[model samples]
Target: MLAVVVAVLVIYKANFPSYLYRYRLQISLSVDGQIYTGSSVIEVVWKCGPKIADSGRCGPTLDGQAAVIDLGSRGAVVATLRTGDTIYPVPHGAVDAVFICANAFGNRSTYEELPALPHLTGRRDLSPSNFPRLVWFSNPADMTSAQKITVENVANVIDSTARFTEAFVEITSDPVVMNIATKLPWFPALKLAQKGKGVLSMPGQFQLVYNMFVGESS
Candidate 1:
């Protein structure tokens, strides 16, 4: 009977829709055989439903891409915790598991991996670049009206994603982009925003938008 009750609860929870929960994060990266620190924001979108019957895999969906604040480099090796960083869930009672520890060049990592830079220590005790933020997981589809409103609690989340998508459409004339295009036409045309800046991208494609400080929001 105990097992049956747990199963039933899981089934009901599985029907819930997934949404992105915004959090303020602090992190450090192992860059160029040294450590760099920065403060940034992350968006962790939850999976809408529960585990598949036998897939043996269940969690927020993520691609190789992620957004980070990129705090330059540090002068010494330290294990200091970041200030004012948090991962508490909004609306309360949401369970979250941070994901990290990717290849340095892959360009992103997780906060959980710090305090014990195992990956770095493994490679002669350091690396050349690492990412330590878990921003923006892909939200599951097939949500109910209740689920829609749950995320709608904050208008900024929706607008944040919108600004990213629309950015690409207007980039041709964007001063920063235009300047980069003229100077380095072959580059990705992406840049890291200053601690107090923002990001922009093509319309409807929020994933492409990382924080950038150069342009005024349109």
Candidate 2:
């Protein structure tokens, strides 16, 4: 009976984090005076373990702690690293390199709750003050000097005509969101793709909406 109980406890510890912390963030982008639209999906899988090395090795081996951002038809961004740490996904082909070098989680997770995007909560006016900063470079060579910019700047940096007139994000995960839930070491990588007239936002301007959902992952 003792051995059986121990085994069950270990199993529960290993599986609960994966069950409770996985999340999917869906984003839609639109520019002023444009009918076209852009979209991207970001999925983060959290696991119960020590930590993952940059080599993307070790730990659960399947569905490990990592962030995958799918930019629709454009391409994808993948990062396997410690939670809340910077995520560096190698850029390939036409995909420009994007790095969440700072404040990936917006607000840190505490013992009582998971990390939350406080800047996006009930925000009517979106600007650099509220949006997390990121770095983008067209040529990998420029990575050394790429300055941190708002998530909205990504679109304009890619194309001049493409400027984000408006944006919306939908995040679904276990427990509550915008407020808090479970905790983890780091969050996930954030990337954007273009489809409509332009990108998502400009520096210190416009608005980005958010809809947070708390539920079980199917």
Give the TM-score of each candidate: 0.23, 0.32
lDDT of 1: 0.26
lDDT of 2 at 38: 27
**Candidate 1 lDDT tens digits, 1-218:** 99999998787765653433333323343333343443323233334443456432323432111222232221111111111123333222221213222232131333222212222321111121222212221221100111111122222422233211000000011121122222212213343332335543343331222122111221
lDDT of each: 0.26, 0.29
lDDT of 2: 0.29
Clashing pairs in 2: 83-185, 83-186, 84-186, 84-187, 162-198, 164-200
Residue lDDT tens for model 2, 6-71: 999888764443312332222233334343332223333333443345222111211122222333
Best by TM-score: 2
* Candidate 2 Cα errors over 4 Å, as ranges: 1-7, 10-19, 22-32, 49-107, 115-161, 173-218
Which window of ten consecutive residues has the lowest lDDT sum in model 2? 93-102
Candidate 1 lands at a TM-score of: 0.23
